[model samples]
Target: MKIAVIDAQGAGLGKTVIKKIRKEIGLNIHITALGTNPTATSNMLKAGANHGLTGENSICNFCNTNSLDSIIGPIGIICSGGIKGEITSSISQSVFNLNCTKYIIPMQKHGIYIPGTINLKIKNIIEEIVSDIKKNIEKLS
Candidate 1:
């Protein structure tokens, strides 16, 4: 499956999510890292993303047309304004607008709100997503 992970600043749980997905599932999956900046994208790439893209065109390029099976990130992945302005309504709308399936993680316990996060109940949500994907894949095979 192709999974797109959007991290606006790489400060949130994107890295952790990627690590868990790789270690726990141990499956050959395509992970795309979409970062607001190169650093965020690189961090996820290091974590395990097979491909990484960042910056303005990067957002416009993949946010809409990319055929990702799923997108995982914090609620802010859709935030429409701020530094670099990469994360905009179009980007958020594209993701929120994706006809494809998606898995969105909520904020941390403190409700402090990170720029981009895709796991709220991180462990449980990821487990559920992985479980469902595995089941669907097995059925398809």
Candidate 2:
């Protein structure tokens, strides 16, 4: 299965998510790191993503043409001018329009909050994400 992990700015969250996915999901799945900047892309690549793409155009083009099974990222990815303005409207629109399952991490930094996720930690959230991805892969298999 092919999955894209999107992130912006420092990409600290992306890197951690990639690492967990790699460690828990193994290497069978293809991971694409879609970053808003080169640094973010580089960091996620180092975390073991099979492929990496940087910038708004690259990310949008990739999402447009690729048949991704899932897209995982902070909820801000869908908001224009999010991630400290690194996420553009075009990028957000492309991701939002993708015909794939989306796993959005509710981040407080984005100033958007989900009612039930208030007490959830980032690590726990990512663990849940990995588990869900595993289930999806199993279903496809």
Candidate 3:
């Protein structure tokens, strides 16, 4: 299955998620790192994403044309001007309108809170995301 992991800023979260997905989900899944900047994309690529793209236009264009099975990233990805303005309205709109399942990580740092998820650890959240991806892959197969 093809999955895109989007991130901005330093991309530490994206890198960690990619590493966990690679280790837990194995190499069968195709991972695309969609970063707001080159550094973020490069870091996620180093973490084992099969491919990567950087910047707003590249991300928007790719998402528009590609058939992604899923998209995983911080909640900010769907919010215009999220990630300290790294996420543009076009990027948010493209990702939000994509015909694919999206796994959004709720980070309090983003200033948005989901009550039930407030105390959940990022590791646990990623595990859940990976597990769900595995299930989706199984269903497709």
Candidate 4:
């Protein structure tokens, strides 16, 4: 499956998510790291993603042309004005409208609170994401 992981800024979250996905899911899956900046994309690629793209254009273009099995990212990504405005309206809207399943990391930040996700640790949330991806990997091929 082609799984896109979107992140911006430091991309520490994307790196961690990619690392876990690589180690846990192995080579059978192809991961695409889509970052708002080059640094974020570089970091995620270093974490073992099969491919990486940088910028809002890349994100929007991919969303427009690709048929993905799943898109995984922080909830912040779907917010139109997130990541200090690096994530544009087009990017947010495209991702928000993707026909594929979306696996979002629920969290409270930037005055936004994901309902029912209070007190959930980031590590625990990541583990759950990996588990969910693993369960769905069999359908990839």
Candidate 5:
């Protein structure tokens, strides 16, 4: 499966997610780190992303044409000018309009409250995503 993990700003979160994915999911799945900046992308790349891309255009291009099976990132990736208000409108539109399954970590810092996910920790969120991915992959058999 081709999974994209996107992030902006410090990208510490993206790096964390990639590390967890690498340790838990193994290398069978392909992971690409898509960041709003080169530093963000490089951070995730060091965490074990098979590939990396940066900038708004790169994100849009990938979203428009590719075989991405799933997208994993903060919920801000779906909102226009989200993620510290740095994500461009085009990036937001692309991810928001994606047809693939999305694994979003609801963040309180973003000032958007997603119902049914209140006060959950980041580690817990990643665990849930990993669990769901395993189940979904199994069912696809």
Candidate 6:
């Protein structure tokens, strides 16, 4: 399946997700890393993304008007001036408005106070996404 993994900044999370998927599913999957910066895209590329694109314009061109099979990322990717504020509003709108299946990683946006950590349950969120992907692929096949 063609999967688009969108991240505004720091592809560490994307890298982790890609690694887990590779470990769990041995099939060759198509991964598109959409990042706001080159570093983020490069990291995901190293993690096994088949292709990578950076910047708001590039991402918009890659994803706009196309109902992708799946989009995996945090809600921030759909929001303007958030985590990776560099993600242009147009790109965010395209992703949010497109008629595509989205796998939003769970994030606790409330009642959390950490000095230097996001405190998000990233592993659990990734697991949920992976499980869903497995089920969908199985049903489709």
The TM-score values for the models, in the order shown, are 0.79, 0.97, 0.97, 0.93, 0.94, 0.85
- Please give, for residues 56-117, the per-residue lDDT of candidate 1 as tens digits: 67766786777877788766666676334547776777778876777766665323466555
List candidate 1 segments past 4 Å from native: 82-86, 108-120
Q: Compared with the true structure, what per-residue lDDT tens digits does model 5 show for residues 1-141?
A: 788999998798899998998898899889989999999999999999999999999999998887777899998888887888878889988887778888888998677998777778899999888888878778777
Q: Local distance difference test, per candidate?
A: 0.73, 0.94, 0.94, 0.87, 0.88, 0.77
lDDT tens readout by residue for model 3, 1-141: 999999999899999999998898899999999999999999999999999999999999999999999999999998999999999999999999999999999999667888898789999999999999989989988
The TM-score of candidate 5 is 0.94
Q: Which ten residues in a row have the lowest lDDT in candidate 2?
A: 108-117
Model 6, TM vs. native: 0.85
lDDT (Cα, tens digit) per residue for candidate 4, span 51-80 = 998898889999999999888888878888
- Model 1 RMSD in Å is 4.3
After superposition, candidate 2 runs with Cα above 4 Å error? none
lDDT of 4: 0.87
Worst 10 residues of 3 by lDDT: 109-118
> Which candidate would rank higher by TM-score, 4 or 6?
4
Residue-wise C-alpha lDDT for candidate 6, range 22-114, written one tens digit per residue: 888755567888988999899988888888999888888888755577888776676676563665688778788767688866555423244
- Sort order, TM-score high to low: 3, 2, 5, 4, 6, 1
Question: Superposing all C-alpha atoms, what RMSD in Å does each candidate have to the true structure?
Answer: 4.3, 0.8, 0.8, 1.3, 1.2, 3.8
Q: Would you list the clashing residue pairs of candidate 3?
A: none
TM-score of 2: 0.97
